[model samples]
Target: MCAEALALLRQQEPWFVSLAILGALYVAAVAYRLLHTSGLALCLRGPKDLRRRYGAWAVVTGPTSGIGRSMALELARRGLNLVLVGRDPGALQDIAGTASDTHGVLTKTVQFDFSLVSTPQGEEAMGRLRQAVERLEVGVLVNNAGVATPHATYLHEADAEAWVRMIRVNLWAVTEVTAAVLPGMVERGRGAVVNIGSGAAEALPSYPLYSVYAATKRYVSQFSRSLCVEYRGKGIDVQCQAPLYVDTKMVTNMVTRGGLLSRLIMPTSDAYAGAAARWIGHRRPVCMPNLGHRLQWCLCHFVPDRALAAHRLRENLRQRAVFQLLRSSSGEGIGGRR
Candidate 1:
């Protein structure tokens, strides 16, 4: 076996050398990015640098809960004022007040429902949203408001209303919100745009049951990349962060029932948001800021697509079972998507 392997290696010596060189370059590039965007990099920057680099004010949607809320607080902690957007007026107000009290940063609330985005009135609302922010020196825009399927459903059997809402929140909101903020950033010649996506979109092979949600996330990744290219030299940075599960309400059910591995894999929303914030000035078009998530992203590239698909299918089935059990035990119906 050794003799035959040696003979084959000699025959493909040039090919092997080329592969080795490519692999080395790939490793070097990844290492550089990892180090540059790591938590250590964040430590090197002063709070004043964040305010200066991204601007004085940051806009965050879905700022009432989950990763969105955590990210908003992170920005406030960095000494940036905040524009908090969400459907709930009271919730938005509460967060705004908290940010003001805790971080001593200015905060404003914008009440808007992404669910109605497809309606004419919703378009007008979005227009107003854009108009409202166009005058502000908005430095950072966090397009974090999004909806995922409540549970994995086959595309053929997916609920139409759910589909529309998910699309409106996940895809349309990103476009509208970014459009709302981009022009101001361009005018000022400096800004950062963070589009929050999911691992399902960029890391997994194919999300079989959550097809539409995954597709929307993929669109976010692609959109962020293209926008970055368009604005790269112009001084605006666009980034899509495709993260794995975070300890948010969206995954509360899974987190409660999942094993140790699942819990370990999903960082708390605060943890994930802090890591993501560190990557803002890294200039990378896409980021999976969590070290564990980065490893998963790399492994998914090497794994066979079909095998990954099978594994996802199995996981979806398990999640479905859990949902069914919860529904049966509690009189409450399915939970809303985040």
Candidate 2:
């Protein structure tokens, strides 16, 4: 009887250990999924109406064109005072003038190259911005300046310096501006931040040339969520808006020459801007402009790695075809003059 019992115990031990290991993995995966899903869900919720309780000012970077310009216009329409930042003094002045004349709101234009935000001069520039807004009672910050590069084989080959510049503008500049305004907002107990992220941050396919850009955006996605968590209870709202290809000069150029695939996924910048405005007012942590994009994100969350990779490869090929067509229609080959 004792010998028989020992044999049974030995057999059962292996099965028990295997079960334990499987259970541990399952728990870990579930925990990770839950955390990721929850964080992002929070980002999708829009900003609270702190404006009614406390009148607000909005600072928008890259306000010269595209979504940034649209956001500036929308904010001004709401009777929010504006501090418009961009590299083009002429364009910035134009935007400020339009906002002031049309909306009857105070508008200040600061001309500086946000591409240099990681440098000492950039720090000084930001300081000047702080001084400019010191008396305006700023309550909202929009980090919207960004740039993208055409695809390249080697990451180092695609103007490594420009990649660094993009990082400074897209990632570091947002961080600096947010940090600068945070204390003031916190002290006042009311503020909001809107970070413009890319749908490419979802890690979908056919963005070989945009790997670095995507990676930086992914950082923004995570950072925005984390900031939301840290600042939610303090009457501060941090939100990220990720949109698919917008019908701005950038995407217009891409689509005109790019193949059919580019046309299929192209979205309008105004649409994205409108969605962002609504989300900001609502205090959503993150907003996806397109319903299709939301579904894609959901699918990516649970799909197997191998299957996802294959799907992305196909999409890349389609995108490449569109890019090729765009180049041809523009009367140039790839790498030719625009």
Candidate 3:
């Protein structure tokens, strides 16, 4: 049977060659993506001389927890001094210490509540941040602060205050901070700004349940692309990193902690930060850093908007059910729609 099949394949020489070529190309592409996602390319080349390429000081907002904390550490590990900005002075100091704050010129802290932007108190905080960052050779800025509706909830049912908070942290704060930092970079002729975005907006064709969160993230993606174009000539690298289902406090409703599937698909904040950090000065203006996420992104593109939206609705409903069951049993510990 094997000999007969081999003989038949040989007779169709052109088709066989074409199929073989296509298979080879497919394998090669997959291999390339795997290498890219694993961050092996960065390892092989070694760390960039970040101090030379960008500057000595890097500013990170919301550096107290989640992706922000991990990113601050990664940058510190790579030899960039840090200015850690967040809501809690104590938490900011705590994260800074973990990043080796005792050492000379390693870290500083700014206490600013991004949710208060444009208020009188917010202006004072912004002025303090400006003072902290402007005099330094601030090379890289990571706008990582963000918020979501507490859980899966309809826009109508969602708290109006929550929408304002999301817009402030996700969109307005990013704009204000970038404005504060960009001038010094332009004067010095180089810097990199990294904005953390959500896959809710970038990967999915439509995200109905969490409409405001998705819209804010969409703004992040657009802002990053437009800023990159506007500043490319001035030696600045602006990037928006769109991550999907990172195992952070924010995604408690979406991922079951420590489950096999969650372990495979959802990168912990530290794991994501390590991979995401390597791509900071890279050329891609907007990108998904995880291999699984990149695959998910490709799949989402082929799916129609209506179907994806329906699927999201279903998932939201399912999660809400889980929340109810757990909450009833455990007395409000379970995450639920706000």
Candidate 4:
């Protein structure tokens, strides 16, 4: 009976066999992604569990606003005392107060501008930052601080000072701060490092107008992956959290103009933070907190790179036009007032 069944199958069709094999492979790939790659595998741990796994304290840079602020608050909720780092002392104090009051967790603030890297002031700030994290038992270091171009433009057209500042904040800060905190984590033999990257790093083919920003984020993802490989058995989980977008002032008008679909797809910072929290101790080298972003990443691979690049270029061109119009209108209004 088995021989007869095999004979009948072999007699049937070659295309059918090929299609069946392809279908099986696709199913397996999907299962692996769901079980290991995506956040679906992440099991959210409570404060007690988190403390046991990571440590008592977590340090978050850019904690004054946006995703940084939300992640800091969420960490506090999970019972980890916080060391909040940001440029605004007032904003830092406010978040510290809220975290302490709401979660009954101790909080400390470190106010320093990352864009000052080329100056004596930057050196002084780095000294202070080093001192801030030295004595504390820092379990998790959230390298969330970053900057982007104010207006989309080619490298030549971009403001020279702003371009340099973006590099200092986005790339320099991550490297310096991580180097400062990593030694302690290594010595302790258990910790987590969460580098907040952008989907610009890998989700699309190429980011044209935002070249510097994309390059910096690519650095972050690579840095995280290499660190994870180097420190795996030592009990340190270095992972990059790269999300597409969240409603935050950093994005300005682009995020605000989105309708209901945008609101749902690109979540608010707080919502994104909550979802991101699930991967705190997750072992993956990267995490896309939003499901929409995960799907976008997967879909981008199916399209041609040139097509994706073309689409991005067109979108960026539209944005540049709109921004120029707004600037000109504002200038005209000011002249009229004069």
Candidate with the greatest TM-score versus the true structure: 4
Model 3 Cα lDDT, one tens digit per residue, 1-338: 99996777778879777898699899999999877755567678776777779999999998887888888888888888999999989998898888885444588899999989988989999999999987899999999998875455677776688789778888999999999999999999999999999888888877766778889999999999999999999999999999998877777756567776665578788888878877888888898877667778878879888898889889878876766676688886432111
Sort order, TM-score high to low: 4, 1, 3, 2
Candidate 4 C-alpha lDDT tens digits along 290-334? 776787787888999999999999988876776678778787311
Clash totals in order: 0, 22, 0, 0
Worst 10 residues of 4 by lDDT: 329-338
Residue 308, candidate 2: Cα error in Å is 4.4
| Model 1 Cα lDDT, one tens digit per residue, 1-338 | 99996677677879886897699899999888766644456567753466888689999999999999999999999899999989999999999999999999998888899988869868877877886687788999999998776577677776698888888999998898888888888888999999998899887878887888899999999999999999988799999998988888787665454676665588888888888887886778888878767767777879899999999999887877887788789966575554
lDDT (C-alpha) at residue 317 in model 3: 82
Query: Model 4 residue 274 lDDT?
Result: 85
Cα RMSD (Å) per model? 5.9, 8.7, 5.1, 4.8
Better of 2 and 3 by TM-score: 3
lDDT of 2 by residue, 157-211 (tens): 5567877877887788888888887888888887888888887775364345567
